[model samples]
Target: MTDQDTLDAPRDGTKEARLVAALTGKGQTLKQLSALLTWQPHTVRAAMTRLRKRGYVIDRVAKTEKSAARFKLRGDRA
Candidate 1:
C-alpha cells in the first residue's frame, strides 16, 4: 500500500480503543507505540490513522520544539 494507504489501513476498533486508553495517561506517537509494541512503524501509523478517523484517538504533541509527542484518548468523545 502507498504511504497514505498504509496509514489508512484497517485495524480492530476495540483493540484500537484499548491502545488509545493505554496511551492516554501518557502521550505516545506512532513511532513510540511501534517501538513499544515491537511492531512496524507503518502498523502503528495505520492504527493511529484508523483510530483518528473513528474519533477514538488523540495525540498530545509537545508545545515546545524540544518536547516529545504523546498519545491519548480524546475525552468522552471516544
Candidate 2:
C-alpha cells in the first residue's frame, strides 16, 4: 500500500492507531500529542516508545532544552 494509504488505514481501535494518525503528517510535540490524546506527557512518551518497538520510525527533532521536541514519522521504511 502507499504511504498515505497506510497512514489512513484504520488501526483496529488502538491508541497507536490514533497516534499514527496524529503523527502521519508533520508530526507533533509531546505536549501537543498529550493534549490531543488527553494523555499525560509520560504516557505520550511511552506510547511513542511502543510505536518505535513496533517498527515505526519516529524521528525526534530537538530544538532547545526548554523547547519541546518535535516528532515525525520517518519516510524511509523498508
Candidate 3:
C-alpha cells in the first residue's frame, strides 16, 4: 500500500498511527514528530520505544553536523 494509505488505515487519527505514517517515507526528525503529534520530544521518543517493544522496526539515524537525528519505520520484525 502507498504511504498515505498506511497513514489512513483504521487506526488513522491516533498519534501513534500518525507517527508511523510520518516515518513510512524519507523518515523524520524528533522535532518534526513532536510537532505533528503536538507532544514533547521526550514523549515522542517514549512512544517510539513502545513501538519498538511491540515489534516495529524503528531505525534511528545518528545526528550529523548538517542535520538532526532522523527516525524511520522499517515495518515489523520478521
TM-score of 1: 0.54
Give each model a TM-score. Answer: 0.54, 0.72, 0.77
Q: All models: lDDT? A: 0.59, 0.75, 0.77
Checking candidate 3 for backbone clashes, the offending pairs are: none
Q: Is candidate 1 or candidate 3 better by lDDT?
A: 3
| Candidate 1 per-residue lDDT over residues 1-78, each given as its tens digit | 122323433355655545655565656766667777677978877877767775454556565586557666554322
Candidate 3 clash total? 0
Cα lDDT tens digits, model 3, 8-30, are 23266788888887887679999
Q: Candidate 3: list runs displaced more than 4 Å.
A: 1-10, 75-78
Segments in model 1 whose C-alpha atoms lie over 4 Å from true places: 1-18, 63-66, 76-78
Best by lDDT: 3
lDDT score, candidate 1, position 47: 72
Q: State in Å the error of residue 24, model 3.
A: 0.9
- Model 2 Cα shift for residue 19 (angstroms): 0.6
